[model samples]
Target: PTAPVAAAAAALCVLAVSPGQAWAASADGPDGPAAYETAEGAKPVKGTAGSGDGPEISPGTYTDSIGRGEKKYYHVDLDAKSSAFISAVAAPEPGSRVKGVGEGLKIRLETVDGSECDGGTEPQFSAEGAAYPVADYATRLIGADDECQKAGAYLFSVEREGPETSDPGRWPLELRYMSEPGLKGGPRLLPGSPDSDEEPGDDETPAPVTSGEKRQAHGGTGFNDAGALAKGVWRDRIKPGETRFYRVPVDWGQRLNASVELGSANSPGEYPPTIYDGFGITAYNPARGRFEDDPFVSYTPDESAQAAVYTPTVDYTSRFDYSTNTPCLAGWHYLAVTVSPQLGKFFKSTAPLTLRVDVTGTAKAGPKYAGDAHAAGFGVSDEDKEQAEKGQNAAEGERSDSLRIVAYVGIGAGVVLILGLAVWTLTARRRAEALPGAPGTPGALGGPAGPGGQAGPDGGSGTV
Candidate 1:
C-alpha cells in the first residue's frame, strides 16, 4: 500500500484559495479581522500564530494489513489568530480557491479493502486539553488527525461564521500542520455487505483477514452524523431465495475488477443474500451538502483473502465508501454496484420502477452504484484466512468482550491447577499425621500419588 504521492513542490502554492476583496471595517486587509469562537461547530478564534503539532503529508492515499488494509492516516494543525466565527473547517480539493463557503470543503477517506476509513473525531492540538481554539500556533494551536498509511493529498474547505453576511477574506488562519500515525482511522466496516446501503449494522460476517505485521488499534467508528443527515432509508429489498450483486465505483482507478461480498443472513451462516448501495438516498445539510454528491466507493488495497459478515435489515446500510484522497485519480471511471443474474425481482411489484441516479461529480448523472461483481486481490492461504476472520468478526460488532472472556478462562484454569497442588500437599501432611510415620507406617504411605494417581508418596505401592 505504499503509494507515491506528489506534494505541490511549493507548500505555499498547494492551496488555491483566493483572498477576497471585501472585508468588514475592523476585519479589513489581507491580514483581516481576528477570529472569535462562537459556540458553534469548530470554535472560532480571535487571533492566529503559535506552536503545535504541524500538518504532515502521507505516503499513499491508502494501505492494508491483518484482517484489513488501507490502514494509514494523516495529522495537520496550525497556530493562527482569526476574528470570524469558524465552525468546523473543511478539507478542500487540491487547489480550490473558494474555501469556507461549504464548497470543496470535505474530509473524505477510504481503506484499501473498500472500508470507509475514518479520521480522528474531535482530536485536537491546542494550548490546553480543554476544547479551546489556539490564539496562535507560534505558541498556541488548532489541529486534527488523518489516516497515515500510503501517501495521498488532502483537500480542505473553509467557512466563516455568520449567515453568509461577511466575506471570509476578513479572517486570517495561521495554520500549522503535522503528521502522526498513532492516531486512528477509528473502526470501519466488516468485509461483506450486510444490509441495504441505507442502514449499515454489525450482525454481519467479518471480511477476509491479513498477515505479516498486524496493527493494534483502540479507536471506534466516527460516523459523521453532524448537521442534517438522514440515518435510515430503504435500498434494495431481497425476497425469499433471491440474490443480487453490485459493482464498486472506483472511477476506473482499479486495475482489475472490484467486488463486494453481499448477503441477507440473519447471522453469518444464514442465507437469502442481498447487497445494495443506499448512499444516494442519504441526505445532508447545506453546510456539508457539497460532498453529498460524492458516491461512496470501496477503496480496495492489496491483501490476501478476507470476508465481512453482518445482518441486513430491510433498511439501508453503507460500508466501504468513497474518498477524495489523492489515490482517486480525477476523471477515471470507477464502478459501483450492479445487480447480477438480474436486477432485484419484484415479487410484490412487476413493472420496472426507475431508481434515482447520481454521481460524485456534479456534471454526470448516472445510476447509483456500490462495488463490483468481480473479486480482486492476492489469494490467501486457508490457515491464515481463518485467523484473520476471527479478528474481523470480533471487530465488526465491537465484540472484543469475547476475547476478554477467553483470557479470563485461561487465568481461571491456571488458578485451578495451583489450588489442586495445595490440596495435594495438605492431604499428604494429614496422612502422615494419621498413620504414615516412616518406620511404623511404611506400608500405609509408600507413595502419595504416582504418575497414574495411584499408591503412595515414594512410588506406586505393591505387595513388595
Candidate 2:
C-alpha cells in the first residue's frame, strides 16, 4: 500500500451474448453459488431447475499424481450427443495435510491446442470437499450456441496455503460422468467414461498420461491435515509469524485472484493477544517462483465458520483479508476469489464469491480491441480449464499507475475507431449515390430522402 499497486481479481461473470440469462441449481450436486457467498448484501439467491441433462462423459473417471511442484490437467472429449464436466470431489493425497478455506485445491480449464481461452463457453471445473469445506467459489457458464460441438478440459493442482506439506496422497477419488439428470454412479467404479464403449470394468481408472515423468515438485493442501497433522484451518501457530506462504501452479504470467477466511482467540495472559487469522496483503511473483514467502499480511480470526467475506483485487504482491475489529470480528469465515477465466469453463463449477474484479484499473489493459481477455497466457484459461484455480490475488491491494497508462491507451483507441468508422460509412454512401442514374439527393443512403428531394426508382438511382 506504500506505492500505487497493480489490481487483479477473477469473478463469476456471465458471458452471455443472448437475451435474458437463466441461473439454476446444479442437479449434478446439492451445493452451489448463493450458499458460498462471504460478502454482505452480495449473497446470491437460490436457484431453480435447469436445461440439458448431462451427456455421458467419454473418459468417465481419471486420476493424476500432481507432484510437489506440478499442475496436472485432463480432457473430456464430447461426441455429437455427449458432453462432460470435471469436478474435484476428493482431496489430492492426504499427505499434504491441506485444509480450510481456499487452501488445498485450485481448478482450471484449457483448450486441446493449449491456447486461447477467454472465449470460454462451457462447464468450468468446480470443487466439493468431504469435510463440509466450501469449494470457496465455483463458476457457472451460460450456454453457448455451439456447445455440443466444442471440447472441454480440466486442470487439477495442489495448493498449500493453510497447513503445509509436499506429499501427494494416494486416496482413490471418485470422478464420474452422469448421462442424465436422474442417473447415479455405480457402487464400484465403472470402466471408462459412460461415453466410452470400452468398459475397463473396475474401480481402477488410471490417467492417460502416467506419473513420475517430468517430476515438477510443488505444494498442495486439503480439507483435513488428517494425514499430516490434527489441525484443519489456517494458522501461523504451527509455523508462527505475521508472514505466511502459499503457491499454485500456472502457465506463467497469468492473472490470479485469491482470498482467505480468518479467526483467532485469547491466551492465558496478554502476550499482545496472540494474532491468528487470514492475511490482508501479500507479495508474490513467478521470478521468485512458486513455494516461497507469499505477499500476505498476518491475520487473526475472531470466530470460526462464522462466515466472513473478503473481496480482493489482489496483485502479484498485494494481499486481501477479513476484519477482526469488534464490529468486524473475524472467525471461521469464507473467502472466494477467482484466479483467471481467460481459459473458459475451467471456473464454471468453483461457485466463486460474487464480486467481479475490474482488472481494468490495475490489469495490463489489453490491446484496446473489442475482444475480451484472450491474450497469450494472460486470461483465466478456458482453453481447457484456464484451472480456471487460476491463482487468486488479494482484493485489498491498492491501485497502481500502470492502470492509468492502460486507460489512456483505451481512450485513444476508441477515438481512432470512431474516426475510422465515420470515414468508411461516408465513402460507402457516396459510392451508392454516384451510381449511374442514381438520385442526386444529399442523403441518398439506406433510408428515405427529404421531401422535395428527388428519389430514383428502387429508392436509388441505380435501379436494376
Candidate 3:
C-alpha cells in the first residue's frame, strides 16, 4: 500500500480504538441524546449494605449505582466546628420506564449511634411517569440541634424504590460531600424582613422580561453540568422522557422568576385530545434540596404549555423558615424542566423550548462565614455572573475541560505517530528501489529468471 494510504489507515485505527474519541463523535451526532456528565475526578465507590461499614467519602464528588429495594451506605468524617452536607442525585437511564409519583430515591444522614441528623429528604418522581434526575441532601448543621452535632463519623445512606412493575435497571447516582465553615460569630438567626415594603397587590402578575433577543443555550443532563443563565431569554430543545438543568446565580435579596414555554405540537386526532400534566418545571436550592414543587400544566398537542415558578427573595434568615424553602440560600439555584416519556408516543421529534428568567431586587451583602463560602458552592461571585452571561456551563468546572483537552492531545499524538511511521516506510522503500539487487528489478532478488521466465506484474518472480 502507498505510504499515504497506510498512514490514513493507522490514524483511523487509532480513533476507532479510542473510547473517548468514539464517545465524543457519537454524542455530537444529530441523533444522539445528551447523557449525564458526572463530576470530574468523581471516584467510583461501592456503597455497603450496612451503615458505617461502607467506604469513607471525603469532601468531593463520587458516583455509584443503586438498585430498587436496596440500600447503599457510605461514611464521612467531619469536624464539630464546621457544618457538613451530603447530597445524592439519582438519574435513570434515558428511555427507562418509571412508575411515577412514589418511585424515587431517599437519602439520610446519621451518627454511628443511629441518631438521625436531619429529617432526611426523599425526592420522588412526580406524576409525569417519566424518569428524570432527582436530588436531595442530608446535612449535619453546626448548632441546629443537640443530636448528631459532634461529628466524628457519620453514615450517609441512599435507598431506591419503585413500583413492582417498573424497570429494574440500576439508577446512576452522583454524590457530593460539602463542608460549610462555622460562622465568624457562631450560628445566629437573622431577623426576617420583607424584601419590599410594597408587595404586589392580589390579582397582579409581574411582567416577564421579553425585550432581549433570545440566545442559544443547551442545558445539561444533570446538576454537575447544568448550563448557566442570567436574566435573559434562552432557547433550547428537549425530547420526550428528557430533563434539562440550568442554574441561575441568585445573590442575597434577589428574587428569581422563571418560566418555560413548550412549542405547539401536532395533534394526534384523538377524541377529547389527551391532556397530560407531565410537563413542568421544578426548582432546587444550592444544596440540591427541593424547595419548590413542580407547577405542572395540562398539556395538549394542539396548544402550547407554559409553567412558571417564582422564588422568594434570598436571605440568610430564609434557611430558618420552614414554611417554604425556596429562598434558603444565595447561590446557584437550579431549574429542572422535564417532558414526560409518554409524550414520545405522540411526538417522535424533539420539541422547541423557550426559557425566560428574571432576577429582581438589588443584591445585598451576604452573611459572614469563618471560611470561604464560595469554595463550598454557597455564594455567588463575579466570575459566576460572567459565566452565565456568556452562556457557559457553570458546573462543567475546569477539571472536565482539562480532561477533554488531554483526550484531544492523545488523538493528535496518534496521528503524528502514524505520519512518522509512514515517512520511515516510504524512505526505506525508495532506498531499496535504488539498490542494484532490488526485489522488483530484472536481475535482482526475487526477480524473474533469464529470458524464458515470465515476470510478475512488478518485475518480481512469478507465482505460477
lDDT of each: 0.23, 0.26, 0.77
Which stretches of candidate 2 lie above 4 Å from their native place?
Answer: 1-65, 73-75, 79-84, 89-106, 115-266, 278-305, 309-464
What are the TM-scores, per candidate, against the unseen true structure? Answer: 0.24, 0.24, 0.76
Q: Model 1, 6-93: lDDT tens per residue?
A: 1211222222221111111223222211122122232222221111221342221111110101112333222121100111322111
* Per-residue lDDT of candidate 3, residues 1-464 (tens digit): 46676666666666545543322321442453455678878999999998747999998899999988889999888887787778898888767778778888888888888888763888887755667788888877776654877748888899998877887988888999877778777776434454642263321335777978999876888787788898989999988877899999988877778899988787877643655675888888787777656676777777788888777767766555566543367788889998876677566878889999988878877777889999988988987887688666754334344545665777777677777877888899999888987867657757665555666445666545
Judging by TM-score against the true structure, name the best candidate.
3
Top lDDT model: 3
User: Which scores higher on TM-score, 2 or 3?
Assistant: 3
Model 2 TM-score (2 dp): 0.24
Count: clashes, candidate 2: 90
* Candidate 3 worst ten-residue window by lDDT: 20-29
Locate the minimum summed-lDDT window of 10 residues in model 1: 133-142
The local distance difference test score of model 2 is: 0.26
Question: Model 2: per-residue lDDT, tens digit, 318-357?
Answer: 1111121011000111122212111112223331111111
